[model samples]
Target chain A: MAKVAAELKYSAEHEWISTDGSGPSVVGVSAVAAEALGDIVYVDLPEVGSTVTAGETCGEIESTKSVSDLYSPVTGEVTEINDGAVGDPALINSDPYGAGWLFKVTVESEGPLLSAQEYAEVNGGEL
Target chain B: MTENYTALYEEHKKLGASFTDFGGWQMPLKYSSELAEHHAVRKAAGLFDLSHMGEVWVTGLEAGALLDYALVGKLSAIADGKAKYSLICNADGGVIDDLIVYRFGDEKYLVVPNAGNAPTVAVALAERAVAFNAKVEDASAITSLIAVQGPKAEAILLKLTAEAQHALVTDLKYYAFNELTVAGHDVILARTGYTGEDGFELFVPNDGAASLWASVAEAGAEFGIVPCGLASRDSLRLEAGMPLYGNELSLERSPFDAGLGGVVALKSKEGDFVGRAALEAVKEAGSQRKLVGLKGLGRRAGRGHYPVLKDGAVVGEVTSGQPSPTLGYPVAMAYVDVEHAELGTALDIDLRGKAEPFEVVALPFYKRQK
Candidate 1:
């Protein structure tokens, strides 16, 4: 089972949002998503200042197994992208929630998200 | 539907292996991280459960003659206790399966085929042997295969057998096999493997799989042996430039197209084998497509069925590809137009609509130190 942060919110597509309720929200694929994706080889992130829509493809994560689209969980203008994770995608597998964060966005609109418990249930207790 | 399991299925399950349906058999995809398992095989040692591969026995006074007619290679000429990689082809020259023929005795041989194509190869062999004095038998159900591959493979394998077998195992050259008793059970230990490393493949009865695996695992523990799965097996083979049956080889392409034309023994063989006429014609008229190795420039690895582009036009397709764990770069085997298959030819692979540049390099991206 993957450890889920209680304070973080998760999307159905497996992206997790850091819920500090502050200026910008950090987003990255959850630990459950990282384990499922295996060893991530490459990460493509949205450019800073680009607008993203919730539940839409904004970037991509390529693993040894296959390529997957990274869906944006909240609609907002991208403020910052993780250059470290982009250069070393394996960080997403090692520290999915911390240093592996994909991008940060200034809040504009949000969609329905799940609590840690709800997200755990959705993944069949895998998260 | 319930899928088939190998004799070591329960053991793999206990080891926390993730299962995948391969060739109708539920086999382990990985026991741990694929990258770790791959490195273990290259650096220390890795054990494999290869029971899913097919083993067919041919026995009779004319067994050698029968196989010569059934396969593309001249099997009868290979010395006893030696193995040769060959291809089973159809009358139309299309490859049915790539197999290894082991001449165990004067009147007996063991044919090992890919798991999925075992039944097909067995049936083809039986059909081809009808006129000869040989009997083909599908012994896959009662047999299991285990491989210990890496730099430390030989050292670990030598400890399991008696001192008498030690000399034979030490003197055993690559592609040679020795029949001996392992833990009081009969086994055929061969010096061969799909990985680009020194390894030994042990063929034993199904009942002996668990014991053999346990003993080998225990003996290999001091050498840091890890039980590997199919995922690493695939990446290792890809780096070795080996063609998988469904991916790089199929009924649609002949051995010539897959760069395996050397396996076709046209000059040495006396009688005409199946597909001889068509393969001869294929040799006379060069194959339209050729298999080549592609070295990916960036991190984006080209996957199977991805288009190989030249000058922004599709000229071929990748058959097997992945990020090489040892080489630290992506590599792929692709079938491209003959004109663009030369070494150092620049090519582009459209990976999900994004083009990644790569260069044609020599096959067997990694070769073991002799």
Candidate 2:
């Protein structure tokens, strides 16, 4: 099982959102979700200027066996994206919470979201 | 989903592996990242419990003759301690399943088939063997398979049994096997593997598999041996340019269409086999499309059934795709028009709605280092 940092916020879809407000909250797939998907090779993230609603699919993260939806954890404007994560998606598989951060988003209006433990309770299996 | 679980289900959880329900089994997909597990098999060694795969035994004098008529390959020529790769096809020459036939003796052979298609393959072999005097018995419940692969495989395998080092694992060549005693149990040790590495796939009785597993882990510790799962299994097999039965080769596509013409013995029509006429006709006419390898020029990876286009026109379909850990590039397998199947031929793949540039290349994308 992966160690979940309590400082970060989470969503029902198992995405982690860290809102230190350096610019926008850095969003990434949770370690639980990344492990489930296997070795990620490709990440499809929205453009920096794109606006997305919470619960909407922003892009996709594809692994060797399947492709899964990368949902927006909060309604926001895309501020920055992780190019390294895009180039080698397995970075997400290795360190999903840290360097494997997918993109950053400026929280639009504090839409639907959950704390790390709350999200863990919803979809948490063995891990 | 209430999927069937493996004997090592708890052990996998203890290892902190990611789980995926494949077929009917809740199997471990990987212990770490797919790339990491894949690299382990190429660089060191990876352990795999392939107990889900089915095994059947054919006994009696007619077993050889029966298998000779049931499969595309000649079973009569297979000597003891040897194995052959074969396919059981439909009357239309479509593959039912790809299997390994182990000639255990003159009148006995063990047929191993894909787990999902075990029942189907067994039924076909039994139906075809009635006239040739063979009996097919599903031995899946009695046997367990463990595929231990990569460069350090032989060294690790040599430690399983004190006697195995000198007689079985060390001296056996590729495709050759030996019947030996392990932990006081009779077993078939084969120098065969799916990862295109120097490895062995051991067939042990069901009861002793757990002991064998624990002992192998203990034996392989120094070589950086890691227990691998189905996730790396797929990537490793893909790197070896091997095809999955459902994805690359299927009932909808004939062997000719899947670039498996090399295995079809059309010239040796001495014995009547399934789909002989259809395979012969296919051989004469030539395949319209052939399975080939495709490498993307950029980061885009083409996945299974995605369309491959040429000049905005669909010319082929991608059968499998992944960023190869060994090659450090996106590689895929596709069935394209034979004219465009040559290496270095430029092509395009449909990335959702957009067209991405790709090129036909020779497989496999990664080769094991000796």
Candidate 1 lDDT, B5-79, residue by residue in tens: 999999999999988999989999888788889999999999999999999999999999999999999999999
Displacement of residue B367 (Cα, Å) in model 2 is 2.5
* DockQ scores of all models, one per candidate: 0.68, 0.66
* lDDT tens digits by residue: candidate 2, B1-370: 3466656667678888878767667777888666677888898998888887889999898888888788888877888889998888888888999999999888999999987788789889888877876789998867788888989988887766676346666789888898886545567888888887889888888778877877777888899889898878887888789999888888877788887776776665487789888888877888889999998898777888899998999999999887777777778999999999999999999988879899998888777656
> TM-score of each model's B chain?
0.98, 0.96
Candidate 1, A74: how far from true, in Å? 1.6
Give the CA lDDT, 0 to 100, for residue B6 in model 1. Answer: 98
RMSD of each: 1.5, 2.4
Off by over 4 Å in 2: A1-4, A19-23, A83-91, A125-127, B1-4, B163-165
- Tell me the TM-score of each prediction against the true structure: 0.97, 0.93
- Clashing pairs in model 1, backbone N/Cα/C closer than 3 A: none
Clashing pairs in 2: none
Please give the lDDT score at residue B92 for candidate 1. 90
- Worst window of 10 by summed lDDT in candidate 1 chain B: B178-187
